[model samples]
Target: MDHDIEKAPSAPPTRRDALRVAAGLLAVGAVPLAAHPAAAYPGDIDVCTGGYDAEYEADLAMAEALFEAEEHRAFAPERPPGRYTLPLRRGFRVSARYGIRGDWLAGHHTGIDLAVPTGTPVYAVSAGVVVLARRSGQYGKAVTVRMRDGHYAVFAHLSRIKVRQGARIRAGARIGSSGATGRATGPHLHLEIRARRGYGSDIDPVRYLARRGAPLL
Candidate 1:
């Protein structure tokens, strides 16, 4: 009674086996699998294309919003009444009102004329930067300060000019002495509050000052 055992047949190589073979071939410097075509890869982006732009736009929007907020704070909403003062320290009279017809101006008086003594110290009505401090034709030695409320405070007919263009001025700070430097019958300080930069944008100076609890005639 002799017994003989029959051996099972070996399995064929699988996909895993083929992959392993390919890897082995590659390790051994085989060019067959190494030269196989593959889909192109774009490597320029540090992050996902959509993701980077979203973050960038979010940051830019945040910055713009912050700037707008700051600009609004700097120049919007009229300041409270009593926020300004009389340009002169002592007795002065409002000889003329805004919109009064005058030959000095093109057609009207653009501001209130305060008839103060000659050489009287003139002060800035509010904290601002001087945009104009020079000799003007009719304004004489003028000084115009741009206020925080986005309005302009123009002081004209100065005997002398103190601040220059681009100078920072404080509220009630002395700018110059008042006089009838240009065409005038008497010594006075001409004050104008414009909504914008120049004469065409001129608004009422007397009412504007009176509402602010300043000295009014």
Candidate 2:
């Protein structure tokens, strides 16, 4: 008895076959997670749609979770208090001072500009509550801390803000780093001592800091 078996030719690969292959590769760690191009989706990716890959949908979810974790780190938690210190220690040279300036909108510069290089650590002048820590219009990445004296200490033109609003940071704590993030010609820290919490209430920050024993000279 001679029984010959003729095997059927292999069918062409479908979309599902390709997806399964990708899933298997991902599961076995053959491909790095960073290789997945999953940043396109701002929300959920519909896996119910035909030909959609489940692994890809999962990649998007992982990327979003990572983003949230990083963001949480940026906004630091509340900390204990310490003594007062100047915004800058070494690069304390004042490039601009508070007073009438024709180039300014208020016909005056509301803050003193410290000519520090980009990424210089700017510390808190005194222990206070951070009222504003976000990307302001012309100030760029700014952080305004309401000091114990009720005056606002404004740190503007920063490259990065380390504290969040309502966080009670200590005196001399690193609030942010200096940069030309706002309307500025170069890297500097725009420091303002305000009588009130508004724009037009600025006073001479150098004299103010000196009186408080945290001289910026």
TM-scores for all candidates: the values are 0.59, 0.60
Q: lDDT values of the candidates?
A: 0.59, 0.61
List model 1 lDDT by residue over 133-173, tens digit each.
76655456778777767788888778888786656667788
Candidate 1 displacement at residue 52 in angstroms: 56
Best prediction by lDDT: 2
Q: Which residue segments of model 1 deviate by more than 4 Å?
A: 1-82, 103-106
In the range 28-141, model 2's lDDT, one tens digit per residue, is 433222222222212322111111223322442233233323223222222332356888867455666666343333446667777778889999998876766777555678
Q: In candidate 2, which residue ranges exceed 4 Å CA deviation?
A: 1-83
Candidate 1 has a TM-score of 0.59
